[model samples]
Target: MARRKKTSPLEDVLDLLAMLPWWACVMLAAVSYFLLHPLAAPIQASDIQGQGGAMVGAMMQKAVIHGLATAGQHIVPLLCLAAAALSAWRRKQRQSLLTEVAQARNTDALDGMSWREFELLVGESYRQQGYCVAEIGGDGPDGGVDLVLAKGGEKFFVQCKQWKAYKVGVTTVRELYGVMAAKGATGGFVVTSGRFTEDAKEFAQGRNIELIDGPRLFAMIQRARQTQGPSTSEHRESAITTGFPQVQAKASVTEPTANSQATTRPDCPRCGAAMEQRTARQGANAGNAFWGCSTYPKCRGTRATG
Candidate 1:
């Protein structure tokens, strides 16, 4: 197995800052420069000439502060800017990976990626879903837990398995469950680039553990890309103001007036036409609201409501 390279202290600090948003790091750079520049400036000679002995101690302290601040004023800002650039690059890379996988004709895109790339892709997917995701860099390709997701005051654990040929088995699911229990996580997810065993599927059922296989994970990324506007916080605030639960872009409850419908309805999957809330009058799913293509007779596309 290939060992992970040891990072220097500066590299570690860069990595920590890179986890923050790029804009935030840029702001920190500005703030640090303004705060340190004054301290770094030359001390006035007149201010130190009044007190003889006390002046020496004070001057020495000021010199130490000045020296440190002189170096720090440049180094700290540079580090922040560098980390900001790295953060922006990583965000762009995640988007690229997401787009590549979402547009792929099959699961080959996922199967061909390295394990680190797969973990990044998974983290990006969760981020798109409005979760603040913290990547817990793993020991290796088959490391224990790869992500820590936080949302709505709840925490979840995620394990990414990039195995191409082998099926994820029940043991992996069990391990995640154990970790979740130990860590007091609300839930857990095991996402793999391949299928899961029947035993694995059975074990995850009713266990608050979601097992996402290649196809489902691909669909999730595609959905996240399609509905990538108006953050979760915005949705929650709107829900509070309107006295309604947060509505998903893909589905909504039926409303009496057409004007009262959600503005962010999804387009038809088949014809790419605007879809509207529809009610099923007959069959097994009667009285249920669904999204139907506006040109229903011409384009028979339909989607289920949430």
Candidate 2:
């Protein structure tokens, strides 16, 4: 039998609460106040004439309930709407950034970034593709993981290596695979701004690990731009908000020369768009080849190839 997933009480309550409509929460709050208020101040109906006392008490209860209900009806909907709107706004910001990164022409812009910025860029790319990304290495060392991507309870680990001068080799992929085993993670990715050695590529085959190098990164960015229908407005928004100038230049990205492969790109893991072979400046497994989303930043999906 399959093991059941366990959730904490708070998680259970929050999950239940999240499923409720805004009006339902209002009703619940009002009803809770009605039930609890009497305990805070006990009703004293005994001081008055029998029927009059009962009537007065009934009136008080009705008044209290109505007042609380009115307050709830007025406040809850606004709070819910604000929360939802803020969520959407943040999501849009992430999406716009993803598009900006994808449309960039050269890896030079990427080269200038600090490691933290690189992690954020990678995380946002996955976020655009619908994964809930958890960043590590902020508070301290993350062993090796820089970001953790999750969806539907499934998790993936990512290690970002901003190495522009060195080639990522088999040992790096081997280390991540070991980490995956220890953490019981579903898969892993090793991303770099350089290339990988042939030995590294051979080691990663059949392992659920993807190696990404620079050119593949640029290619995916281009695809992501295409997928989203690049707009001038997108550039203006990112520029105004972040003060980062957009760098754009068209370069021939690495892809398969084989006619068959060119005709049939693999499907995207996140969006189901076609995946293409883009050689990573530091290709994940092999310095020569890696698969990237043809619709990147927009899809952020990639695969490792032999």
Top candidate when judged by lDDT against the true structure: 1
Model 2 misplacement above 4 A: 1-97, 138-142, 228-306
TM-scores of the candidates in the order shown: 0.70, 0.46
User: Model 1 over residues 142-169: C-alpha lDDT tens digits?
Assistant: 3388887665456678988888678999
Cα TM-score of candidate 1: 0.70
- Consecutive 10-residue window with the lowest summed lDDT within model 1: 233-242
Report lDDT (Cα) of residue 196, candidate 2. Answer: 88
Per-residue error for 206 in candidate 1, Å, reads: 2.7
Assess candidate 1 and give its lDDT.
Answer: 0.75
- The candidate that wins on TM-score is 1
